[model samples]
Target: MSAATLAAADSATMLRRYLLRMRRYPSLTVLLVGMPVLLLLLFVHVFGGTLGAGLPGGALPGADGRGRYLDFVTPALVVAAAIGAAQGTAISVAMDRTTGIVARFRTMAISPVSVLAGHVLGSVVQSVLAMGVLLVAAVALGYRPGAGFAGWVALAGFLVLLSLALTWLCLALGLLSDSVETASNLPMPLLLLPFLGSGFVPVESMPAGLRWFAAHQPATPVIETVRGLLDGRADAGTAATAVAWCAVLALAGWAWSLRLFRRTTTG
Candidate 1:
């Protein structure tokens, strides 16, 4: 077989292994999937109406405060769910490293890239699945986005890119850690980023320093772009910016992860 074919085969095998392991556990995935749904429920039913009422008039067209709030918050929760899934990546990667699976792979004929690719693929898959469950729960809760077919396509593309970027970052963090606990904790800040961004509220609603930070952070542009797309007000510049951020992050994380993986497996 050609080199490309061999790599593909190895990656597929690794991917199946990762998926089967996840299926056996189920609990971690359940927690990863459920947290976002619970948060969505709490935010929409419990706090959404009040928060929506507090928004300036005309925040969203043709919708009441609660409805508008749901529209705004759903994407954030989706992103949050994706990030939450990264915690699983970090933990899984750390477990593999600590348990000597990675070392064993190094002594075998398996493709090196496949080792990382499998985990990254699994993480992204799980994240997307979690996002889907979150979306279903959101729709059941009366969260109606204004996006049409093309818009939904754009949203899916955006989500996939974001998941890839975040998953890689988590993997790198996992590889960098000395323990599974450390790896799991390293990505905890990601969960807090949505709150800091324009996720739950508009950037303008924050204090001056916070508002500036909120507007410029990676999450803001992505969230804004998602919000615009869903609300039928897509902006090309914002979309480009979001893509740029995801690309840069994915590249950085991929490079960092390779370095750490090599260091750990060979040393």
Candidate 2:
């Protein structure tokens, strides 16, 4: 087989390996799905009514405060679910490193790219699965989205791009960490980005300094784009900005990860 074909075969095998690992050890998947569901329930049931009443325009017409809040917050929760999956990717990568598995692979005839590719593909699948479950939970809680078929398509594309970007970044973080604990903790800040931005509340409602920061941050545009797409009123500018951010992050993470992986494996 050609080098490309060999690499593809190797990557497929590695992907299967990662997926089986996930199935055999289901705690990570459970945590990834459960945390977002719990947060969704807590926000919509406990705090939704009060918070929804405070939205700039108040609740939607014919909708109660809790329902309104559920609609508003579901996109952010989906983003949070993606972030949680990325955290799992980092931990998985770190485990491979510390367990001497990666070192063992280096001595074999496998394609070097296959290892990282497996993690990226596996994590993206996990992220999408978690987001799907979260969305179902949101719908069950009376979160009604205004998205039509096209809007749903756009939303899925954007989510896949976001997950791909985040997965690569976490892959780099995993390769960078000296220990699994550190890898697990390094991505924690990403989980907070949605909350700190326009995830839980409107950016305009924040203090001046915080509001400016929130509006300018990457997460805000991302969340806003998701919100807009779901409402079938996506802004061209916000979508462009979000796509640009994803492109930059994906490229940076891919370069950083490849460099680190080569250095660690070959040196």
Candidate 3:
């Protein structure tokens, strides 16, 4: 068989393996898919309700209502939905690596390339499900899209891209980690940056210096870009900035994950 034919066969085989694994543990599906929706409810029903309306302006230039915590929280929820899965995916994937499942899979027709990507495919699916649940919950909680249908579509696309980028990063981390625990913990610092961004609170509300950093952070641009799309008022700068952030992270994470995978596999 030619190398191309062999490669195609390997990919198909790997995808089958992935589906079988997913079927065996449906709750992994629940955990990956349900957690984001739960967080959205927690924030909107509880925190957003009180805090959103209480904000100084009642609503800012981009958001629907500073008072409508649902609107305020939904944009952040999108980001949270994207990033939240990274930690869980990392820990789970790391366990697969440490236990020699990855090695075993590597020896099969499945290539190392397929092994890592298979895990990321799962994450991408989970992210989309989480987003759907969150979207319904947000709307139910009185979160209306001020931007309209096109805006909603853009927002959805952004979340998907963000999820892809993050899933790859987590995969890399999972590969490089000393253990599953480290893989899980490594993403927290990056995760927290979103909070400082326009997610839960406006960057302007944050302390001046911290605001500067927060405003410039990856999450900041993502949140802004997402919020703008959701509200139908996305700024070009914010959208461009968010796209740039995703690009940088995606490239870095993909290269690093591959390198780490090689080192781990060889060593």
Clashes of each: 0, 0, 4
Give the Cα-based TM-score of candidate 1 against the true structure: 0.96
Using lDDT, give the best candidate's number: 2
lDDT by candidate, in order shown? 0.89, 0.92, 0.76
Residue-level lDDT of model 3, residues 1-267, one tens digit each, is: 877676666666665665677679777667766776787767755666557766656653223443377777787877887787766678778888879887786676545676777777777777777777777877876677887888877777888788888988888887778798898888878678778877887777888999999877788888888888888999998798888888888888899988988887787
Model 1, stretches more than 4 Å misplaced?
Answer: 58-64
Better of 1 and 2 by TM-score: 2
1-267 per-residue lDDT for model 2 (tens digits): 999999999999999999999899999899998999999989988898889888888664323888888888999999999999999999999999999999999999999999999999999999999999999998887777888999999999999999999999999999999999999999999988998899999998999999988998899999999999988999999999999999898999999999999998987
Summarize candidate 1's per-residue lDDT along 7-74 as a digit string, tens digits: 89999999998899889999999999999999997887787777887777764333366676787799
* Prediction RMSDs, each to the true structure: 2.2, 1.7, 3.2
TM-score-best of 2 and 3: 2
Model 3 ranges off by over 4 Å: 1-9, 59-67
Q: Compute each candidate's TM-score over C-alphas.
A: 0.96, 0.97, 0.89
Q: Rank the candidates by TM-score, best first.
A: 2, 1, 3
